[model samples]
Target: MRWFSSPLRDCASPRDPSVSRSRVFIYLGLAVTLLLLSYQLILDRGPGIGTSWTAIQGIIVAGDEDRFVPDYVQPAEKELVLAAMQASNMSWVEEHLSDWQVNIYRADAKHDDVGLTVPVNKGNEAMVYLTYIIDRYWSLPEVSVFLHGGRYQWHVDNPLYDSVISISHLNLDFVQEAGYVNLRCAWSVGCPRELEPARYLRERPDDKGHPTAVEYPDRFMELFPRAEVPEVVGTPCCSQFALSKTKIHEQSLEHYVRLQQWLMDTELDAGISGRILEYSWHMIFGKPAQYCLDQRECYCRTYGYCNMTDSDIQNQWVWRGLQLPEGWPEQSESAE
Candidate 1:
């Protein structure tokens, strides 16, 4: 085997004592240069987290076409997601951000004849979301980020702008470290013991399954007509997460199609649909949902929004109408 100084070692051991010392010095100098050059490789490559070198594709599903009139639809919060991505120092993120696939599903009927059919209600968000995921994003082999109207849902009274600004601060380094980095949006609650008698979708530990998550057998049937009810149902709300396209490819095309068809068939309202989807999402990925706690900060983005305030938790249930048990505390704190 060839060593870095194998040749030098033979030359360094000379027969004459006079030249032996000088030969040793020459060998030592060459050894130092080789060692130093090798060490430079590590020094040049700074601490990089584990992330596929593939380019990242940001998918902004903006269905809210109206914000001018409060009655129509709330203005999309896509600016925050965009602003955050642009703020990232990661050269790849800034250079090759996949063409922003803005699925503006909601259209103005009075202005012009848009797509053949348009559902203006929030319930339609799921339908549009699935279409983009199954048909559009399935082909993308890089990282796929799913952002709701490119906005961040808050638990505190902090301005949406601030919550997003904080999330936007999630630099390239942070994203690379996480496999499927997500936003807590609010507290993580499991199935109510009284209802499902189980905390997870399957018989397992407290991994991703919430202890207080209640079962929604009826909603499960509605969402997946033929599929059986998962042993446990975990509620992970807010469809805001970044996953590699490789992870998504793990799910079968048939699975995506079934999910899309199920959403189309659901007769429930937007609020209920969102709840059912919350739990089902983790199941599709075969993992638990991440609810950010005040102490642990790794589950969410770099910003503090993931560490939701008391008011933020309250708004999730009281205002958002997420199903909480009879004894769950009501929101009293100011959201501001």
Candidate 2:
């Protein structure tokens, strides 16, 4: 009747101490490796996340004592987002937009250290512009103005084609009211009927083998699958524009991400992909295919060039500030 040790108890011995310790060490190693990878991913995303967080907290990231803000003008809740190439001149932004937050996304891989950098420089300004919207969608300023990196470009709507002048005189009130404003008000380049989708889809040998037009139809469908391809697509040339946060939020972040994904996946060269976006931007921002605003009204509303007549717009007097003709209508308070 002595106590008997069961065979089951004898077989069920504790695991070897070394084996148990080895598993613990293995788990520790895996956890450290995962953490390192996560950190590297955050680094790859660059300063966009950090900047967005700080911006959400109401902090202005860049300001210079040397930059002058006129005493009469109060600080504004606006941001200027630029898409810069390697050789683009950004000095004008520092010199002119002292009161606004400026975010420059460098498209060139060579200039890695300059400004904010896009993940890949595929679709020209389209890549940078879409990236800014997707990144800062959660923490956008009251109004975000997107522009090319150069201070002076032919695409700009200002009389001198100077971004500095256009942005400096930009009517934020109009932007607030309009929701989406094409920075270029002129219709000389792209407007009324810039691209005929049916015509562009036809391949032609004379295009020097560049098949951008031939490729645009498929690309357009990729971007807006649910919508029909319009016969004509038009908007002011280049991608410089502004959007109030309210307008930006009208389309969900997923909408922008899908557009960015199309940019990444498209095989069209940077120039052509960018050109397609150059026309599609207005539609993306809820404007009609023929997004040609009245030239006089656009200048008066978007840039405070009030009372500009068709002749003045034709002569580019909006930017020149020539003497107003007698009995010109008073400047609308809304324009101011």
TM-score of each: 0.45, 0.68
Error of 1 at 214 (Å): 8.8
Q: Per-residue lDDT of 204-271 in model 2, one digit per residue for the tens?
A: 23455645656667788888888888888777777888999999999997788778777877778898
Q: Residue-wise lDDT of candidate 1 within 1-336, one digit each (tens)?
A: 754667777777657877788999999999999999989987876554232122222322232232111111122212112211222232333333333333333322332444211333434345544544554333453444454432323321123322344344443345344434454433434322112423234543443353223335655565566666654443434555555555566777667666765555666665566556655665566454323334234323434336655665444333333332232234323431
Task: Flag regions of model 2 displaced more than 4 Å.
Answer: 1-76, 109-114, 199-210, 317-336
Give the lDDT of residue 6 in candidate 1.
73
Candidate 1: list runs displaced more than 4 Å. Answer: 1-103, 107-124, 150-163, 171-179, 185-215, 221-232, 289-336
Model 1, TM vs. native = 0.45
Cα-based RMSD of the predictions, in order? 17.8, 14.0
